[model samples]
Target chain A: MATELPSNIKSSDVLTDQTSSKWLPPGLALQKVDERIMTLNVGPQHPGSGHMRLIVQIDGDYIVACDPDPGYVHRGEEKMAEYRNYITNIPHLERPVIHDSCNVLYPYVLGVEELLGIEVPERAKYVRVIASELNRCIYIMYWLAIYGIFLGHSTMFMWPAGDRELLIDLMEKMTGARVTHAHFVPGGVRNDLPPNFEEVCLRQVAYFEKRIKEYAAVFYDNPILIARTQDTGVLSRQDAIRLGTTGSVLRASGVDYDLRQKEPYDVYEELDIHSNVMKEGDSYARSKIPWLDMMESCNIIRQALQKMPKSGSVRVKLKPNPKGKGLNTVYKRVESGRGSLGCYIVSDGKPEPYRVKLSVPSFRNLIALPYLLKGEKLGNMPSVYWSLNYWPVEADR
Target chain B: MIGTATGIIRALNSGIKHLAIKRFTLRYPEEKLKFVGDGYQFDPSTGVGIAGLKGRHLLFHDHCTGCQLCSIACEGVAEAIAMVKVPEEHKQNKKAIMPQIDYGKCVFCGLCVDACPFYALYMTNDYELSSFSKEGLIYTPAQLQVKPYVAQDSEIIITSRGATHG
Candidate 1:
């Protein structure tokens, strides 16, 4: 249906000055007209916003423009890495996205190993895959929980948050920490798995898979959510690629690009990974893809556990204060929970790195926010925004 | 109207089903998690630290040589470990300087445990180190020597209904 403007309305009338005469000079008189539009700053302190603000301009119920203002939680992680030595940087480097610490540190570990010319053991690769997949579900559950509350579904928030502990419990048993595992390192993982880890992991993950399937009835397939989200902030295939969006935002628009399948890292090439894609490219599709990916993650974890060698070392013995080859640089990218997280390192043959740069997916995916939000209803702001899977701290860092 | 009604009912049904399921939260302070090993320890022979939670640092006064390796290792990371002058006299610790860890700044990454060539520094499962004062949190060399008492027996049990940490 085409929206036709009233014949009596003129283009200049829509842009009429509304300032009072007291605020302007005597010679310049302000026009008196009824105000139909208002600006809303939803941000920084709002529960719906994750440390960033959205400058929204709404005309009646429709939003005219939405500008995403980021960089509220920036701590300059890349700058801090230059001062610390290779081994010491791990703890602080994973702080940007603590819940998804393994994946955030994956590309950094890969790049550092490349610079040091260390070959990881076969068992370590399989262990890394399991840990990465587990961390993926943990991070996604947290995101989904917030996505639920943003859409006024309180039960959706509670269930995902509760079930996420199953994965976090397994992570704690395996890597020692609940969220910030700091498990991945330059040569390999920090330590080997605990005894009877396989059985415990298998049991918890199987239950977790069962729990996530129940979300389909409650959150994903609900008619109210579909009405509020579907066709509201639609992004076509051309715009998604043209805007340089990554992860679920890109995949929701019928793009079948998943870095795990395309540029396979570690044991990803050995394992079978099915990239979840949807053609709708609305808020619903963006939200549904992550749930599909969580199921795929469970499948990948089961495959990794069955194929993993029974007994072997998880960490390679690295010399104290290990340094890279002189004046060399390396860039590595890994498929993280948010999207493709890449790390670029330039080593100067010293213990400390020369420079480090992170190409975070949250910042990349945020580019499409303003594009999708324009001309959308004001009520659909939270549904459209949170569905993009934007992590503020990671993006700002 | 039928589709909407069923959708709401289905969602409510899922929520109601979980009400019969047990809670997954661990009642902390009263109940701590049981770890697999005693603590995270490094063997010089293997050159790899064993798998465990990186918690409070436990210093072995007898094994410490006042080497300052752990303090040096923590410089770029947390700067929580400091080499301070000690009054006691020992053959190994000739310098009379021992490492004092301030828990305020520690990230508990356990890099210091890996840096100790001698089996002097290791991590224990005692994570409950909360204190009233800032000075109380700074564990001295003598304080680190004493082992912490921790009682943890909780584990996640999966049942026909659901999973719970008990």
Candidate 2:
């Protein structure tokens, strides 16, 4: 919200009051400021804002009020899903968060499979687990890269960007696409893993784990970064749950609830997953949790590879234009890059869905932005805001 | 002050170490990463299509029966494939129609290839399909028939020091 200035003013008065007043339209006159609070529009075009605006009012470098403005990149993905068939919606549904396509499509596939009443093969479950883990790391690395850039750490940005390619390369061999792999479909995945995939996957993922460990020395353990973000924008454990925060943000606040661990999906129950939690409830804790999760994902991938069936079908054959049995609604959720991503589909016994609703984690985590941003310093904005792992595109979708 | 200095030095040291490491970037146009298979193919016996990068479409004029399954599949996702009247007539294609794909609108999802049961359509690793004009992007049936020649030999080589694309 913009403040209204006076309607009329003299040129001499305007020059005298120029220090306190901002430039207005030619016809509008300057108004006398009652309080010294200045409003700053961190617009959508800014790199740090990520297609969302933050209306912040500052009083001497301290943020007095912060209002997050999302929905700049909304494409109405839910409405579009109603027109498309179950099989065709994969490519478009994964577009909101392309790097984490597997996780985004995970819930949709699960819901569709339930509606169809078909069981996924044992091999398919392990393959799905591997893909989901790889996608999780890919999404985290991209988020970390952006977080690094926002904090003015250029080396942090480059390292994650470079290291992300290893996972991306692995994903490409499995799913055919680099980022937007519409591999996960109803009943099962699109195809089986490529020949000689296990060796390549194991080797690359091992190297990637070693590469990620190098980041702690230069980034997470860096004293300057620690001092800047350690105690700033502290979110208490109760506040996090009351505000309905999920994923890393919630974990940082000492809640050890991971969807993969709590409500195990696919082959996640078979594999051992350690939930990383921190009690600090600060930006540093939020930033560190994802790295720990990435390490856990690496272990899960190795375990899945070992337990996966050597020779079996990865997909269950479904009839062309598959439809639900009855007029019913099904809701399925999976742990995505940001947090819990839920997909609710209302089927009316037709090829097309009657209604589709996506409960995205980005939008859910955005509730904590204004709460955390208020009374914080201006310089801490980027570190605190990005540490929440808010992807505006996913939120807006 | 000492802690800050050590942090800065560690960051600088990490950066300098990476400078000695080989670049992971693949110099495009001159080098391309080689794919595993020829293209993404579907078998009628099997429900799933083989895994490969969904790049450019390869159409077989003989096997295509002008059934319009690929066009139907692309309708909801990306309406990039449209059936057009071809000059050459085939016995299988009685309508003398073939699918012409608009690369500009195509998401390269490979659903179209899976929709074709006759093994008439597949995707090749010809991702370098940049065009200057809109008209140039719409590949005709005849154009789609021509197999692209790609010289890709690069692969990721990981050593004790670091990984490099070579």
Candidate 3:
């Protein structure tokens, strides 16, 4: 049986009532609340929210509250890592952020090397830095493409996507695959750079930098984009720090902390690393920081290529079925594309790790979503939500 | 007002400038992209790998000793490699067993190649492995031994205007 709408209830009111007896079976109805307040599910399937749901409660045009529901794309990556040995875990561990696979694996590799007591070669260190920087650009470009599409800018999407291929091509030459580059192993990289790789890398990186610079004219400088995102969903510095936001979210909030600069893992200490910090904690600044970081990545790749040893072994060969020491634990963190990605490993003299935990930036940055989207307009949802640089798979993993 | 107008104009100008640049895509069926080398190969002595595309795998019948290292390596990751009995007789491979890779499940991680100490298994640039049936996806020892033909000839060429596959 169907029920007619009451005289007082508007057409939009039908959607707001989740416990209406009209749709549900009899006796399933719950108590009703204020009529003006509406609940919006911004997708486990919506274009704006990719593979995650945002339970948004709105009053008129303003958002009263927004709850980010991650784990729709969760694959139990941490549990899977415990079953497999260290070497076998490489393929699946990088699955969370495959576009930036090198950085995602960086922390895990460092932690494993610590447990195994293997000293990485100097050439390998430089090579790892270069790969990490290249992967960072690849990831930022992919993120920028999605961010552009979220803000209804198709041209912004196309330019970053097409320009991204330049780095992807270089990556395909370095590592076999374009995206899921299981290139980083425990000791060092799986393979050394191909012959003539330096010249090709230098040429492509120069062009890629030039290409990304042009994005400012189209995306960041566009009047429409500036107006839509400039002051909306501002995360204050104090709130950001208190909430413990990482990566670009923290950097955009005027907290000048970069793991590569502060911690200096691998060869970051030797290189001139410049952290991009912005005073404006709005969506615009949060989105622009990654772009600036990409420019910095280009410089890093050039420097690493120059300083890399002329000829040496990239990987320290280990015995088959390598096992970590008994009663050992190591924690390692690196600056991934999204933010500071940390890996915690516990070994008990077994081929398989006793415990593996990945503290991903996407999940850490997600804590700021409800805080940022609290009083933002419904129209500003996409820009504000995406500018936090939250990747759903990484967050859920 | 002037700043807004100028910003709009600059965005428009940049978009228009890209119109003159060449399209950055390959006509896939007619033109295939070229690869750097024969395939991804590892030297057990050097303990380092050579860079190449990780497509379908190539198994050397003469080199493989039925050690089952590739199968063991792939068990945790994809379970794509399975040891199968071979009819062909070889002096090195006394057990007459070799790896049969199911392409449908293979993640192309190249761990199997790295695991093979005898230089028996290596990945080739032949990535195109589509078939009508799932059964056709699994390549047997005999099938893996044969080198598939690849027609790839295109590579990315950067110019003053832009980069394009040429």
* Winning model by lDDT: 3
lDDT of 3 by residue, A1-397 (tens): 3555556767676553545545754323332456888989888874533498888889999999887888798899999999999999999999998889999999999999999999999989998999999999999998899999989899988888988989999999999898999999988899999999999999999989989998989999899999999999899999999988999999999999999999999999999999999989999999999999999999999999998898999999998888998989999999999899999999999999999999999988989999899888999999998899988888888
Cα lDDT tens digits for candidate 1, A304-362: 99999988877888988999999999999999998889999999999899999999999
Models 1 onward score TM values of: 0.92, 0.93, 0.94
Best-to-worst order by TM-score is: 3, 2, 1
Native-to-model Cα distance after best TM-score fit, residue B155 in candidate 1, in Å: 0.7
Q: Per-residue lDDT tens digits of candidate 2, residues B4-82?
A: 8988899778777877787688897788897878767777578877877778999999999999999999999999999
DockQ of each: 0.70, 0.70, 0.84
Model 3, stretches more than 4 Å misplaced? Answer: A1-32, A46-50
Best by TM-score: 3
Q: What is every candidate's alpha-carbon RMSD to the true fold?
A: 6.0, 5.1, 4.9
TM-score of chain B of each: 0.95, 0.93, 0.97
Model 2 lDDT per residue over A109-130, tens place: 9998998898999999999999
Which structure among the candidates has the greatest DockQ?
3
Residue B128's C-alpha lDDT in candidate 1?
A: 87
On a 0 to 1 DockQ scale, where is model 3?
Answer: 0.84
| Residue A69, candidate 1: alpha-carbon lDDT | 82
